[model samples]
Target chain A: MTKAKVYHDGAVSGARRAVDAVMTVLLAALCIVWIYPVFLILINSLKAETAISTTSVFELPTAASFVGLGNYIYGITKLNFLSSFCYSLIITVTSVVLILLCCSMCGWYITRVPGIFSQAMYLLCVFSMVVPFQMVMFTLSKTADSLRLNTPFNIAIIYLGFGAGLAVFMFTGFMKSVPIAVEEAAMIDGCNALQIFFRIVFPILKPTMISTAILETMWVWNDYLLPTLVLDIKKYRTIPMAIQYFRGSYGKVEMGPMMACIMITVLPIIIMYLFCQKYIIEGVIAGAVKG
Target chain B: MEKAIKKYWPVFLLPTFAAFVIGFIWPFLWGIYLSFHKFVTVSKTTFVGLDNYFSVFSDPTFVSAFWFTAKFTIVSTILINVLAFALALMLTRGLKGTNVFRTVFFLPNLIGGIVLGYIWQILLNGILTNLGLPLLALDAKYGFWGLIILMCWQQIGYMMIIYIAGLQNVPGDLIEAASIDGATSMQTLFKVKLPMVMPSVTICTFLTLTNSFKLFDQNLSLTGGEPAKASQMLALNIYDTIFSRSGAQWKGIGQAKAVIFFLLVVAIALVQLYFTRRKEVQQ
Candidate 1:
């Protein structure tokens, strides 16, 4: 597969090597720039409050250096880490399952129905992707407060609505690539629509489901705005909201522990992304380029 | 059985339809209605005509935020696409270690906006602290640039993945044809490779535009319109109007701004789609 080298002259290989070296050096420099800030925060998080404030963030830690998880331990206690983690996990897991089920069903129906309405509804879902969360913030919050459904369950319901559009969009795209003959064969075997979806079609959508799960899990888990508005109670604070409150309540900035808290919240997202990145990219390409 | 299925279509669709109506449709309709009303709550809404829209236009802060957002969107979109396309091209050369490099670069995109914002804030603050300008005291220009950098870093990897997909699907025969016709490397890239990637380009551009405009969590966590709200984007401005500020007077104004924001987004997106879809080939 290698192309015949026009650059086979004596100086060509040398020049090519030089160019490659320069590109590698430049890319390495950019990588440092990209990744060093993260290192700065991680280092600062280990130091004492005074050390963080007084010394350069780049400074090496001395004998006083080994606070040895004190900052992290304290951050957990201060940020109400257990409560927030639980709350976030509950909301994220529950909402993702619900969104996946409902959006999959809805997507199935939309794709199956040969009507103008289904087409219009599909377009609506795509259009909703661009709707800013702020557009619905006030009315929805006020409506939630008025209906008195601002509890955790109600908040989950709200997430379903907010998530439905994107989920349906993804499901529909993936479903289109699914063969109709399979569905017809399942139908001929006396499979009801529900049975077909749950037993046959749904299993094929495992990858998209995972993609949706990862995407929504990250959004709902780390979501600040929606939870901030709805789950204002201390008992129900999600991790991001708790971190915000912790930051606000400290009055004076405590860089070490705050960064520690931030890292704790960020860890799950980074881990999930690292593992599911291939699926994420495929799902994004399928969902993104179509519309 | 077919008749039964036909009759039950509505039943199957009803749950999702109801939820969509209540959750998305209702709020959107109410937002449009509320934009013309004066009220703290939906129940208290009073028809105030286009007064809210009037105030939104006259507000200096809103104007500045609009311009700031537009400029930020333009710069970040360009930077993200260019960087992503370049990276995609480099990686698609079948080079060793490219997958590892792609994974490393794309890791940042997986982090949530709010977390990325706060992380970058600390890092930028560290650098700025040396220059004797805290993140807080830095001018709107600094905030603007900070956001652009953060957004570019997070988005470049995502756009790269898209461009990579686009590049992979570019038929080798097209490149071979160009080469056989005596096209130079740059000529092949511009005439053959670039044309083939137009679909990806369109999609990537639209994604960048919408994402930049609707940005909220990051804008909130990063600078939060620091240095006197000078860095406020349009979305942040609408949010602050509703929550940070008191009084029902501006609720309608916020809604009005949102409607305007919606129209702007839709119009631009439609135009972009039309332009890009025209360039897409059957293959």
Candidate 2:
């Protein structure tokens, strides 16, 4: 058998295998280090505030004081969870849907019909992408106030504008890979433009659509900036802004419940990521790698 | 030609064009114009020529913030891309459970900047307490590094995914040829693989550099430039100047800064593109 080899070579391979094993273990350990803070927050979130403050965050709850979900319940109630929760949900879903529709239509159009104007429009959009959001925040906010879009719908419009550049870029790139033959086939079959898009093109574009949707959803869901500027009323505060209030009220070091609040805030994103993880990963790789 | 234009163009192009102009183009133009005007509100802006530019240039805090952002973009861009590329190499070695590892590493990224900022603030300050220093300090260096660390952790996996894809697309024959020619793994990487991955590196570097410069939410949540405004980035400084400082009414100044910021980012991005594109070998 080839297994019967030279001793020196065998020893060299053995040492190499050992080195690989050690590196693998080290990588695993580093990943654990990377993610353990999340676990720390999660478990500590379940404990009562007193237990959290007194006990080491690493320790388990005692049988006498195994309070189940108390921290979450109390934290939510104290933080006005219901209103902020609704606000965040409404804003995020609405913005995402609007963004997707606008981006897809624009993406399909600009890519399919190549011209000087569309090219200029596309460059303008690209420029918008690199332009720092803060640069435009003052002007946009003032404009929004002037237009009186300070309502939820207005916030959604701002998001649509902000999100369109990247989404259109992705959609256009993906659309390039889809040949003109498909659309022409539909057209020859007497399909109207709307019919052709809905029946033929959209289904083919599902993967990109899903990728765009997942990415945009995560972005709008967790976004704190636009919402902060637009929705000034205390009643309209989203979860991130609500958490800001909590931070201010509690001052610097309120570990237990504040951590619980953070866990609550991140819950939706974590949940969404769990479901759309693969598509999100694929989208990021495709988009960034190609650039 | 007229008939074809009527038949095909509008069907495919109208919706996107209308949306792009209304949603992005108009606002972007308005944003540029608003920088040169002074007003308590958007509609009320009055053009004031180069006065805003003069004020923005002279402001000490703005100047410091600009330097801070430059330093940040430089260091973090190098650190994030280098580390991410290394991790990409390790993870792409046909290892078991690479997908799971990628997912774990990427989770931080999916979490928003603000959320990640707060989470890391708690986690980091928890450690810093043992060192007898608060997370926010006088020099802002702690917050600066903390941000760099947070940015690196959150961004590495995203960049790694790109790097992995680039590594995969690298011509296998070239790698094999290098190895056959008695090249070590390091030599193969530096001499062969890196040149091929220049496109990916270029894209990743440009993105990280711009992202670092533009970061605001994380900077706000993490430090807010505490202890005498040491950690404020250019974006945050502009934000504070426009909004937080009452009667600063320095819309013109803020706009000047924005204009300058835009020019700098565009210039850097262009230079980076040129340098990287020149080195990109066509397969």
Candidate 3:
């Protein structure tokens, strides 16, 4: 019986090892496939415009085809890539900060003060989440125009409104989990409502706040439709909008410069992601779980 | 405390309330009103009752777009969830370099939809050309599958993270008990592991369902509903109808389509939540 058991154990262990080896190889191959498309663009971004189209885009840039920063220069000077990048940065930062501050305060009030009005406000914010942007695109554009919200700086206000649903929802959900005694104790010590919120409650809500900030930043940064409709496109463009217009313009697309601009646009986000990857992953999971 | 908080309610809530009114509330109400009126612009309007809604039903393109979006959403949501769940299972097995792999997979999700669409457009076109097949723009089927692939690429990682969280929370004692009772690997997975991960499954499904339904940027930049608008999803269809159409009546018709689309999403989401929430086992 002992010998038979030993043989069976050996067989199972061998099979497990084989499965592990196969899975590792399979995952490695998939990783390559996932990364290849982006890599292809990066390499092609350096080639001369003539070579970009004449040869397969998969081919490496040769000595003859290498222009070396030529595309970057053209993208910045002619394609308005720099201005769009600056606009994207400004809008994302401003919108994220505004949403975080405004929604957190609103979320706290509604959660702490129980009443018909607060309940209705909370429900409305939740309801807004499911409403598709296309449902309001036309009227929204018109509204933005009338309100003079056609600039990047002012566009943050629009983001706050549209973003309030998710932000307030997440914030209130997190707030409910917080211990009420902490706030009450602070209040008893004579800290004003604003002081207690900013000095005490806000610190405890840091994780959720970070998560909210990251979520809003990602949305506002990558958002193409809202800004495209709300902003004066002639005067200001987000990175995605600029990329679309550049590719959509008449005649043959300057693939080299376009790819360069894409690289420039994607690099900063990737770097930020790498630095705070843990928080981003945590934030996404937290946000989804609450959502 | 209540009085203190109430006295400062204007400070606490007004910014968000004011913005929400401007951003969502007014636009939402205006959109519904516009659906009942004929207008070249917001200011130019004439009340037309149910005429615009009637025109939406008659537009074959809008109807076809609805069906197309439905099929795409079903396929992509299933693909993304299943693959993401499988990946989560594999990565949670104490594997080497799992974190690195997770990060790599999640990278695509960070890229914007428009950029994702254009990148996939070029790549798919290249591969299809090499394979002697029609480019993505030339064939509706290719666009459909291309969008699915792009969506899975972007979403699977996100869902995987959620699934991973769910998977890690599965009580180890339960798995050990099942194994000690001689439960097979397949049996443990199906009977034990899956039941515990249903919450993540619910969240992932809700996300994928809504996202695939509301997809616009990718649909626009990828194929732009080429080949006579065969592949246009509802959102893109509504956009084209509102903006690209010349007649003033098309705007209201598009608005009606938007209302219908909104209702369809809300109904589906509620039903999904109802069913999925029922299946979740309370810890």
Candidate 4:
């Protein structure tokens, strides 16, 4: 796959090796550039509020400038970080779980049963995926409020509604590719459709289930606009909403605590990526390819 | 099994369908209906004909927002795909730490847009200030370029990963045959590699196009369309029109804008789908 070969004669392998070496260094530098802003936030988070001024932004925290965990402490207390984290956690987990379970069942049913009803449902789900949130935001929030789905606990149903399209699409795509021979055997063995699905087909769906879960988690966790619109912000706040509130009220931003809040908001997702990167990447690929 | 399972529809399909009705179908139809009416609230809405759309079209900020979003989408999509493809080409080469490079590049994508926006704001504002230039929000041009830069950084890794997968699937034997036929690298890339990765191109371009058009969170946090809303994209423009204003007229206009935006997306998605299907037929 190396293009260096096409650039050189038969005896230029050493030159190609050097070219590869140089390219490696260039990529490494680009990687540093890629990761620099986050690193900058980390350093500035530890700096004293006074020392994190624009001129001194890139400088490492000196003894006089360092505040250790002070900004984190301030951010936790003032930004209301912990409760927001709890809210975000609840909303994301509940939404992802609900979407995966309901959509998987729905996906299985629609594919297995052939009818106009199934086809229409499938088309609607697919159509909803491309409709931008703006189209639905005004009425969605109003509907959620009226239905009392505006709370953190019940908002997952809304997530279920919004997320069903992609989940069902991916699920049905995989479901169609799975042969029905085993399912038929289970049917012959006196297993009802429910039993075979729960005991047999569900297990076969673990890979897709995992990927779907990851995609949903990444979305619902970091989502800002939906929760803000759907939930009564006075009563509930997700991490992104809280972050918006941190600097949202006034443009006279509080740099120190804002930095802490940014770090807090990003930390868990970064840790999760480090641990489950392969799954996350693959899941993203699956999600993207669905369109 | 199909016969038996069909009887159990209530157990499996009912819940999702119910939620889908409540969550998507109801809102979608209601949104479309609301777009044409002037409403302070749903109960207070009055049928306004095309009055809301008239307001939307006449508003200069909304008009500029459409053009700005169009320009931003075009520039960012081109830049992101080109750079991402280059990075994919580089990273796909057998090299030490390729995995590490790929990991680092892909990390920012997992982080939320609002967080990514603030991170860049801090860095960009700090640098601009140190250099005695206008901060990101202070000038529309700076805000424009700031968004361009941020979008590139955030999306390149994601598009690169897709492009890598595409490149990897381009069948090694074809490449070998090209080289054996005395084809240079550029020729191989344009004729063989590029044609083969058309699927990836289609997906990547589709994603980047729609995402760039539909962008909200990053644009909101990064610039908030400051300097008199000169930098607001269509999404943010719709948001501010509905949320920031105190009157029913703006809400109706916002809803109208949303409808227009939705139609635009559906049209583009359909066109892309048509091209992809045609390609599949040829292949």
For residues A1-291, write the lDDT of model 2, one tens digit per residue. 012122225775687568667767877887998788688778777776666542255666676545677767777776677778788888888888877776776777777767776687678777777777776776666666666767765577778777778888888888888878878877778777677778887888888887788778767877787788877756588877876666656455555566777787777777877787778888777667434
Give the lowest summed-lDDT range of ten residues in model 4 chain A: A2-11
Docking class of 4: medium
TM-score (chain B) for candidate 1 is 0.96
Highest DockQ against the true fold, candidate:
4
**lDDT by residue for model 2 over B34-78, one digit each (tens)?**
777887766566778778888887889998898888899899999
Expressed between 0 and 1, the share of native interface contacts present in candidate 2 is: 0.40
Return the top candidate by lDDT.
Answer: 3
State the C-alpha lDDT per candidate. Answer: 0.79, 0.76, 0.90, 0.90
**Lowest lDDT block of 10, candidate 2 chain A:** A1-10
Whole-model lDDT, model 1: 0.79
Models, CA RMSD each: 2.3, 3.5, 2.7, 1.8
Comparing chain B with the reference, what is the TM-score for each candidate? 0.96, 0.93, 0.98, 0.96
After superposition, the stretches of candidate 3 with alpha carbons farther than 4 Å from their true spots are: A1-10
**Stretches of candidate 1 exceeding 4 Å from the true structure:** A1-18, B134-137
Report the Cα lDDT for residue A195, model 2: 77
State the TM-score for model 2: 0.91
Model 4 per-residue lDDT tens digits across residues A146-256: 998988999999999999998999999999999999999999999998998999999999989988998888889989999999998887899889878867886677888
Which of the two, 1 or 3, has more lDDT?
Answer: 3
- Candidate 3, A104-126: lDDT as tens digits: 99999999888998898899999
Higher-ranked by TM-score: 2 or 3: 3
User: In candidate 1, which residue pairs clash?
Assistant: none
